[model samples]
Target: MKGISILGATGSIGTQTLDVVRNSNDDFKLIGVTANSSVDKMKEIIKEFNPKYIGMMDADSAIKIKEFCLENNFKVQVYSGMEGLIKISTLDEIDIVVTSVVGMIGLKPTIAAIEAKKDIALANKETLVVAGELVMRKAREEGVRILPVDSEHGAIFQALQGNEIKDLKKIILTASGGPFRGKSKDFIKNVTLEEALNHPNWSMGSKITIDSATLMNKGLEVIEAHWLFDCNYESIQVLVHPQSIIHSMVEYRDASIIAQIGSPDMRLPIQYALNYPKRKEKVAKEIDFYEITSLTFEKPDIDTFKCLRLAFDAGKKGGLMPTVLNGANEVAVSLFLNKKIKFLDIADIIEDAMTIFEEYTHNDITIDNIIELDEKVRKYVINKKG
Candidate 1:
């Protein structure tokens, strides 16, 4: 059985990953699980999987989980903080580390797992967006496989499986166009939190849902594709497919386009990552082609969704620019959710932060440098509001 450690086990991706594991119990074992502060959910997972280790970033939450486990006479080790998450990633028996945690907080543990030679089923795009060069280089040095978990990247990986890299022309990533697809710039400028969170196809965390609405999620995927496929920024293209049936596509130089189609379920991609080079049967939705009328595609409106343009700019700038973009966007999203900033300000804050820190460049992306840059950008954004 392949021992698996799932970071951010309480989130949407984590829950779906556990579902995949549950369906294929004979092929996999849950060795470790980590969450930010969802103690009740973590406790429930621990009771079901009885993983050898569990981690929580919040100390009180971890202690509460430990207490509950003790009350129930359960035997499971509990840990807290970033160190705890890092330790869980390096568990000796773990063959695959699913970095499904959201945000930049996932970077350190993912790096630790790679250093330990654990195969990475990566869902944390921020880890790559902020430090793609460093993470990819470390994976190569350690000879560890960095498998893509995002449906788009996973589709590209599957499409390129048997094809020679030299034959590749470009990667065409599909977007659902989100809930605000055709909204005019004026309409989107006044959008509320509920509208942004209402993703048309994929059910995801709040942050990702917002990113999807703004098309920034697709932009980040472009950066991810560049690193994963060793392609330049020009080789990645984003197309809006409102149906979301086609996760992503790859075009060969010979004018052939290969695409992966599936129901919009996270479990399928998670299972595929776990059982790489193989297929597994699980309880997932099946596509009904007869009932579906048609598939529509359009060009993304970069005029309104400026986040997409900003992300492309960061990716092309390379090095620390992507990190700054990711960091500033994270802070901006938080502010928007808190009602401190308007929805449009999310793009404005990121763009402003990038301009202020233009001198940092892509080569200045040491871990310490990224952490400092992230803090600096957050402070700059917060102060700008005041």
Candidate 2:
């Protein structure tokens, strides 16, 4: 049995990861879990999984979880904040660390797990987006496997099996184009949060949903695929596919394209990460070619979704630029979600931060440097229009 620690045990991917673990019959075991502040959800997960350790990024939430565990005679170690996340990630029993937490917060714990020689099941693309060079190097040094847990990356992983990486031409990542696909900039400016959050294909967290609408999520994935597959940013392409069945495709130098097609379910990738180099009984739904009629593709409107363009620029620059871009986008998206800023302002804020942080694009790629830059960019974006 593989022992795993879930870093964001209460979020969309985290909860679904737990579902995957629960459904498995002794093939996987939960050793640790973490949450930001969802004490109720954390408590339910603890009750169900009985993980040995839990980290609550919010100190107050950790206190509540501790109280509940103590009152119920539940034996579990509960820690709080960033330090807690790192500690649990390095736990001895956890052979696999499922870094599912969104944003750059997952970066540090992922480094911790890699340093501990724990294989990573990476759902948090922001980890690679911000510090791909540093993170991938650390994984290599530690001799730890960094498996892709995102559907697109997982599809590429599956497609590349038994094929030499040297023979690969390019990776084509498919996007659902989100709810705002064909809408022009003028139309998007008037869109509300609910409208942007209404992703047509999959259920995701609010931050990701907003990123999808702006096509910035696809842009970030492009950067991630570059790091995961060790390909050039130019070699990674994105196609706006309305149907998400073809999650992603891999092209060879021989002009052959291999695609991994499946129902739009996150569980497939999550479980595949857990069972690396092995296939298990299916948990999620399979594709029904009979019911599926057509699959259409288009070029994403980078002119309309400037955030996507900004991501490409930052990614191509390749340093602290992507870190600043990810940080700025996070703050901007959070502000838009809270109604503190207009939806279109999200890209504007990111662009501003990118322009300002370009001077530091050559900064050190150390983990500490990345974290410092992430915080600086977030503060810059948060206070720019405040």
Candidate 3:
């Protein structure tokens, strides 16, 4: 059995990943699990999986969990903070490290896992959005397998299985377009956080939900597609597919398109990544032909959801521009979620920060440089609200 570790055990993807693991118990083992501050949820996961180690980004939460473990005589090691996360990520028993944490926090642990010779099942888009160059290079150097856990990426990966890289023409990344897909700018202007967080197809965390509403999630996925598939920015295209039945597709030079169609469930992708080079029993429902009348696709309106356009611009520029875009968007989304900024202002803030960083910090592409730039961009965006 291949041992696996989950870095964001309490998260949406993390929880679903566990379900996949549970169903595939004969082939996989849960070696570790982690979360930020979800003590109760973490506790439940710990009891169920009985992982060897657990880490919490929140120090106090780790302490509470450790105390609970000690009192209950549960055999587990609890670690806290970034260093703890790195340690858990590098555990010898874990052959696969599922990086499910939402943002930049997942990057380092993922890199650590790669260095330790653990294959990565990557769900966090920010890890690629910020440091795709460095992360991809490191994975290549270590001969690590960086599997895509996101549904669209996973679909593209599956479609390219038997095909030659040279035969690939383009990747067709699909988006559900969120709950506000058909709404115009004026309609979106007054949209509340509730509406933005209410994703139409996928149940995700608040940050990703907001990103989907703004179409920035698709943008980051495009950048990620560039890194993962070694495709040109021009070749990775995003289409608004409202049905989300076709997770994603790839067009070949031979004029044939291969698509991975399934129910809009994250677990399918997670299971696919977990069992590489092998197809397992299905965890999600298969698409019902009778219930699905038709699948519709449309061009994403860059004018309305300008964050998508900004992401393309940044991805096209390369270097630290994508990092700046991601960092700034994280801050902007945080501000909007806190009711400190308007819904439409999210794109404006990201655009402004991207322009500034592209003009100034575009020269640095090193991991350290990107991390530093990430912090500065976040601070600049946050401090500007004053």
Candidate 4:
């Protein structure tokens, strides 16, 4: 059985990952799990999985979990903070590290896991977006496989199997166009948080839902594709497919497109990552082709959703710019969710942060540098807001 460590164990991806693990009990072992402040959910997961180590990024949450476990007479080791996360990432028995942690915080632990010679199932796009060059290079140097857990990248990976890289032309990434797909800029300006959170095709965490609304999620995926596929930014194109049936497509030089279609269930991709070079049976919604008669695609409105443009610029600029962009967006998204800023302010804040930062190219990025950059960007955003 392959031993696995799941980061962000209480979130949507982490919970679904556990479901996949439950389905393949005989094939996989849950060694460790980590979450960020969801004590109740973490407690439930600990009871079910009985992982050897559990971590909470928030110390108070860890304390709450520890007290609850003690009061309930549960025997489980609990840890807190970044060190705890790193400890779990480097666990000896873990063959695979499933990083579902949201935001730029995932970058360091993911690199640590890769350096430890663990295969990575990456759901955190910010990890790749911020440090794709370093992460992908390190994975290559260590001979570690970084599997894509995001549906778009996973679909592209599935389509690229047994295909020659030389024949690949462009990657077509499909987006749900979010809840504000065809709405005018004026309409979007007045969009409330509830409207933005109402994703048509998928159930996801709030940050991601907001990113989807701003088309920043697609932008991050574009950067992620560049790293995962060893392709240029220009070769990656985003298509607004409202149906979300076609996860993503790969176009060959001969003008043929290979696409992967499935129901918008993250479990399928998560399971695919866990069982590489094999397929497994799991409980998820299956697509019925007859009922869905049409699949249409359109260009994203770059005029309105400026986050996509900002991400592309950062991707092209390379180096620490993407890190700044990711960090700023994370802070901005948090602020927007708290109602400190309006929905459109998310992109505005990111763009401002990107402009104010100096891009540095580092051949060797230590965990320290990643943390420093993350803090610097967060502080920059906060100062700008003040």
Q: Give the least accurate 10-residue stretch of model 4, judged by summed lDDT.
A: 358-367
Which has the higher TM-score value, candidate number 1 or candidate number 4? 1
| Model 4: colliding residue pairs | none
Q: Lowest-lDDT window of 10 residues in candidate 3?
A: 355-364
Candidate 2 per-residue lDDT, tens place, 1-386, comes to 88889999899999899889988888988989999999999889878888889899999989999999999988999999999899989999889999989998898888889999999999998999988998899999999999999999999999999999999999999999999899888898989999999999999999999999988899899889888999997888889999999999999999999999998999999989899888888989977889999999999899999887888898888878998889988888899899889888989888888889888879888888888888888878777765
- Looking at model 3, residue 315 earns an lDDT score of 91
**What value of lDDT does candidate 3 attain over all alpha carbons?**
0.91
Please give the lDDT score for candidate 1: 0.91
TM-score of 4: 0.96
TM-score, every prediction: 0.98, 0.98, 0.98, 0.96
Pairs that collide, model 1: 319-362, 320-362
lDDT of 3 by residue, 1-386 (tens): 99889989889999999899889957998998889999999989878878889899999999999998999889999999998789988999889999999988988898899999999999999999888988899999999999999999999999999889999999999999888887899999999888788887888999999999999999999999999999998888899999999999999998899999999999999999999989899999987899988999999999999899999999998878988899999999999999999899999999888777776566768878888899999889989962
Model 1 lDDT per residue over 43-134, tens place: 88988999989999999998998899899988888999998899999999999999999999999999999999999999999999988989
lDDT scores in order: 0.91, 0.90, 0.91, 0.90
